[model samples]
Target chain A: MTSAPPATPVPAGVRATARIRATADGRGGTALPLLTGEGPLALRRTRGEGAEAGVMLVGAMSAPLGGDHLAVEADVGAGARLALATAAATLALPGRGGAPARYDVRLTLEGDAALRWLPEPLVSVRGSDLRVRTRAELAPGARLLLREEQVLGRAGEPGGLLRSRLTVTRAGRPLLDQELACGPGAPAGWDGPAGLAGHRSLGQLLVVDPAFEKAPAAAAVLGEFAAVTPLAGPAVLVTALAPDALRLRELLDAARRTYGW
Target chain B: MASSLAALLVLADGRFPAGGHAHSGGAEAACAAGRIHDAATLAEFCRGRLHTAGLVAAGLAAAAALGLDPAELDAAADARTPSPALRTAGRRLGRQLMRAARATWPAPELDALAAAFPRGAHQPVVLGLTARAAGLGPLDAAHVAAYESVGGPATATVRLLGLDPFEASGVLARLAPELDAVAAEAAAAARRARTEGTEALPAASSPLLEIAAEIHADWPVRLFAS
Candidate 1:
């Protein structure tokens, strides 16, 4: 019996790029002069109330397979307000390449502008590896509300390797910078008491506003596994852990309501 | 070398009066929630804390000990800490540590750090500077920090849960090898930061610890301050 030929390594997955630029129309309404989507990242303009402009992220195809490079950029002009959301949760899937997938998100807010980035959860499926990095630059008067949720795996399956980093800066000074690693290949004891503490899902909500500079948020616990605390800068952070995605979202929603978001 | 080693021991000692005894390093909250009910769970808690928060703190301390700018490291520490409660506790502990460090080993750099942050810097940053002032190297600083990260929580668990003292000590004893490895990794990261900048430092975080710390801070009646 002859052994089959060794499998050939596939080339890198798709390199997708998407961008959105929102500006105020000077009459309290927002204008989206730039909306570009490529590969798996699709941007669609949806109706929004008040002076805010809504943009929904629609996945055009299955993407972020191993070795894929994806990037999304959003720029909110002065006095503009932009609210961005995802149509559905993102699934990280395994591919032929041994390399991990990469997703980079860059958000910029000009003076007096505001942005709300409420994307759906990113699920780490078994055998997949993904690295996500998010960077936000805010002007002094700008405000930002961002949310991130991660589910370890689907159903009873164990999750793959997942690493995420978040960095936020205001006027070129660091406000918040943190990284989290989960699943296989992460440091040992990550699921133990001091880490995720046996939780399968985790989420965080970041709220930055000029008003917070005047009166910082008072620290409080929103649930059994969730709490809200103010940052040294003009921001408030809510962090939570749950057994499932549904419970994680519920905790975050409760925190948002408590903060009047 | 012998005096420096003594300094390392003094710095790592719980009786050093750094006010670390007042903080449980999230063990109090975990204890209250029944997550750390005994020696085994306490060991699990310490193991997790050792790898995540402990590693991060050790990296910062190592960087500081390498003679990096205290102000920059303090800002980096602030960036890495998302929970305001933990940040506040760190600064208070930093202040207490700074006072002890200055009295024990007077140095111009320590004076400058205190002047720059009158309120207090982050505890890990102060610890690194203290190690520097004591003629210790980055590795020594990392070792001190890595041990402190779990030591405080381990000691606190004994008080909070009334666990066996010998078991608590055994948990720490069993973790000695891991502490050594974490310190080495942290020191290497600090060495990388010399050329790569503070961004090279470890940013690993434990989400549950941050959340629990915030909750613990608001507890009307709690044994530990954080």
Candidate 2:
């Protein structure tokens, strides 16, 4: 009888990694040559528009609990296009470990490549602590459209500790680097007048296009709580705050339509 | 390090001709939107600004005073600031402050900064370089930045809402301890950044301030420039 291999023991908290690599096919379409997922991070290929490869993030189990370490990396080669989305909102919950969970996302785009990262909002539940960091590196002539949203808490909860940082570099130069801290243990007055101003939901949409180098986006307020501004580089950033997640997505969607993206 | 305390006073003075008086630090917009009216709301606004924007500005100033590259620090400041209107305002104020610094304390670094930027660098960068030129330490620069973060808005609130001057000043006075703590934290961050890199500096953000500043810039009739 053939002996079955011993099952690997899973760690206490989840340690997951998801990787994706997209390359351009000869016929002007994109193909994912590599797609890997481990532990709770599951990656599924989905149908995308012409010339673009779409990947949907599917959670295989309840993960990213306190003390969990999750990482996702995506690389788009030259002339390739990729779209990434999430199946549902990620909920950060307290675990037995009581340590802060960490989620890191790294993206790389080669020459003339494009990436659209549209993930669902991350909800910080009560008594949970989560830190998320996203870094994107783009080569010359590359384009990126990234959207991130955070819902402070669920319906009647005050939420837990959440810290998020986004850093983007193009051609090895700094484009945008910002960090937002909310919920418990953040700086004082985070929800005060100059911070969220009593708003619960916050999000940002970043668009980096080489074409913006010529005709940059004009600085304008998109709504009462949303404003669009051009960065120092050839990019535009839209920041918005709302009372809830649905309204926050509406604001960002409206901004997406404004740019026809 | 022994330095001229009077120089710190002069640089931190609200009456100094650095064009800060023309900017409300988003207080004007808050008042217009009714987010800040009485002294209580004003205090809350100032505290929020102090912790987020104030902390970031103080770190940059402290790093610059420690003799970090002004060009790199300016770029870092640009990366931190996501608003074009705020960027313009910062440069404009930097230009104005550069003129004042050149007259007050002449330094080759300041001259090089002015020549390199031509238009101007970010104000906190210029402020830190000015503090260096004045023979001040990084903590001094951090203190000046922390003070100015709340001072501008406090002064503007007095004018915008017609709040009691004593109350406005009291609000600032009550924030003295927090200001000192922020300045200390900023100076420490700057020290770490000096060795580790500019990424070590704080990047705390105030979204409402940024959003309101964008809307304020488009105001046809506004008392303040930002």
So what's the TM-score on candidate 1? Answer: 0.93
Interface RMSD over true interface Cα atoms for each candidate:
1.1, 0.8
Q: How many residue pairs clash in each candidate?
A: 0, 0
Give the per-residue lDDT digits (tens) of candidate 1, residues A154-194.
Answer: 88999889999998989987888888998998887788888
True contacts kept of each: 0.82, 0.76
| Model 1 residue pairs with clashes | none
lDDT of each: 0.90, 0.92
Q: What are the root-mean-square deviations of the candidates from the true structure over C-alphas?
A: 3.2, 5.0
- Local accuracy of candidate 1 as per-residue lDDT tens digits, B66-177: 9998888998899889888888999999999999999999999999999999999999999999999999999999999999998999999889888889999999999999
* B134-154 per-residue lDDT for model 2 (tens digits): 999999999999999999999
Q: Which ten residues in a row have the lowest lDDT in candidate 2 chain B?
A: B199-208
